[model samples]
Target: MRDADTPRQEPTDDRSHPAALTPQQRADLIRAAAAEVRERVQAWRDNPNWRNTPANSHRYETTLGAIGVLSELPEPQTEEALASLADAVRPIVVEWRPSRPGPEQSIYAAVERLWRTIDVHT
Candidate 1:
């Protein structure tokens, strides 16, 4: 069952849609998202308790690896150039959730905002 208030999920077919962006636009969106993620991860690492929890530490490392891959691109990519990247990376964004409610709200909120922006921009 579905509710009228629920937002419709965007179709996954990158090639068939009229709203589809050009290769350059997709690349720009990817770069922007990657930059935002990197900045957030850096702030997380700066927290004194970030390394105290093994799970948190592992998450930080995984985020670092993802950022590294994004940063290593020889040049900015095009929309077609980024389709594979988007497919490979979307799952990671989908899997993220805020672990707690207070300060964690910012991270989760940012994730949601970023997700929406990427969805539309890409």
Candidate 2:
């Protein structure tokens, strides 16, 4: 147990810190989320009902925006880049609701995963 006289010690490994992520980890996460979004987009593209609702259209646009941002992330990604991606997708993350329940949920969940990774590590 630490006592009042004892000094607080810092983590020796940066990865053990609350907000530290390796470059590979960040890039892998971005790639994974982008792939998931792509799959959802494909599924929705096959379903005319997915686009009938106005709310669904907005959500679809944001997911496409997420894909664009994710695609634009440069190699050897930085915290700033991940944070910017998070910022760009924040509205959709907060506002997500599928017109139907299948593919859109997957897209929302994929973006949520990206948000969690960035929020925790960036």
Candidate 3:
């Protein structure tokens, strides 16, 4: 019988939960999410509507910098990696206002998906 002080355990067979994942598995998922962030950011930058002003350029650089940090993170740093990804995608998630549906929206959606993974699993 389980004691009152003992914690309940989640099923390991459910890969969707982070508690059920090995460190390597979590790192792999974080890497995939980071890759998606990179792809979406690149697409946004490539869009003709994107401006080349200094402020915009700075935002782009900062976001990419965060992604780079996440990419190089070693395994067993899942929380750190997620923090970096969140920082990387903040501009897209919070600031960018696309006039119409385009790469900006794609980038936003990608960021949201990454955060969702963190939320659901973590």
Candidate 4:
């Protein structure tokens, strides 16, 4: 048995939970997420270390696509989809590092973190 102080893990059933959001709500969530993403992207762009790295640019593009998909998803399904999308993008981010010559760090990880944070609040 778990201790009382332990946090409860919410049950997740995609069918029931994901299907609960209305279309408008989903769109709103997407917009909010996109705004956050844009801010992060701008930060990345402003970073001198990130400017010259081609890998970072590619990662940024991939994140943009993911954000688009997130925006298009049905409201109810957004949570599950975002979680899955974050997972999918994590590896790409991890493989990218600024130190590597050809394949430096990508924005994937940062994006994933952003998605996860959004998922929690929404």
Candidate 5:
């Protein structure tokens, strides 16, 4: 028997989602990602065409998908999803290069830096 107003709860697998970590980890990820990207704003401004490159384009979209989930989901619980996202983005970031000026590389570099924190802490 259940109350009509009770929210439906899905059974969560134990291992697929690790035990929730401290919320500080979540805050740190968001902070680091923001700082990394913001610091490279000038580079992005200088080489606006980097977005057109295939590697950068793919990297950018993958990063956004990770961030989308991170931003939308609750913290601690978001850790597993974040780790999966980081793992997926790693290869792309590793292979990415600047198609424009060297400064343009900072965009993906920033992304890599952000992803590292997620990798290291998790």
Candidate 6:
């Protein structure tokens, strides 16, 4: 029965989305997600053959989708923290060959955005 201009109400359940997160909780989520990105990038880099494979592409896509959400975390970033992440990803950039933007490029892109977001906010 409310008019369209009425401000929408947030869920009072305290379990809804970002509202459920305290600053510490949100920071922890960001840390965890960044860690996952670092780990996945290392996993791919360590096993170079997996970069452009057929069977693994699906899995990479799913992981990238998750990383995309992590990259979108709504928080101001600390550059020192983000710098290590960018450094973790630096080697990935070194290995990239320009053909098209596929799995490796997508992974690279997400981490690139992640660090850049963190840097910009800092």
How far out, in Å, is residue 121 in model 1?
9.2
Q: Model 5: number of clashes?
A: 0
Each prediction's whole-model lDDT (CA): 0.59, 0.62, 0.62, 0.50, 0.52, 0.48
Q: What does candidate 1's lDDT look like per residue over 3-40, in tens digits?
A: 99977664454543323656666666666766676577
Off by over 4 Å in 1: 1-20, 74-80, 117-122
Q: Could you estimate the TM-score for every candidate?
A: 0.62, 0.62, 0.63, 0.41, 0.46, 0.33
Cα lDDT for residue 76, model 4? 47
The per-residue C-alpha lDDT of model 3 at residue 17 equals 75
**Candidate order (lDDT):** 2, 3, 1, 5, 4, 6
Candidate 3 TM-score to native: 0.63
lDDT of 4 by residue, 10-34 (tens): 4443432322555445445445545
Worst 10 residues of 5 by lDDT: 10-19
Candidate 4, which segments miss by more than 4 Å at Cα?
A: 1-19, 64-110, 113-122
What does candidate 2's lDDT look like per residue over 16-97, in tens digits?
4335556666666656766666676668767766556687666667667766776686655666665665565555566665
How far is 30's C-alpha from truth in model 3 (Å)?
1.5
Better of 2 and 5 by lDDT: 2
Give the range of the ten consecutive residues with the poorest summed lDDT in model 6. Answer: 10-19
Error of 4 at 56 (Å): 1.0
Q: Listing every candidate in turn, what is its Cα RMSD in Å to the true structure after a full C-alpha superposition?
A: 6.7, 9.9, 10.7, 8.9, 15.6, 11.3
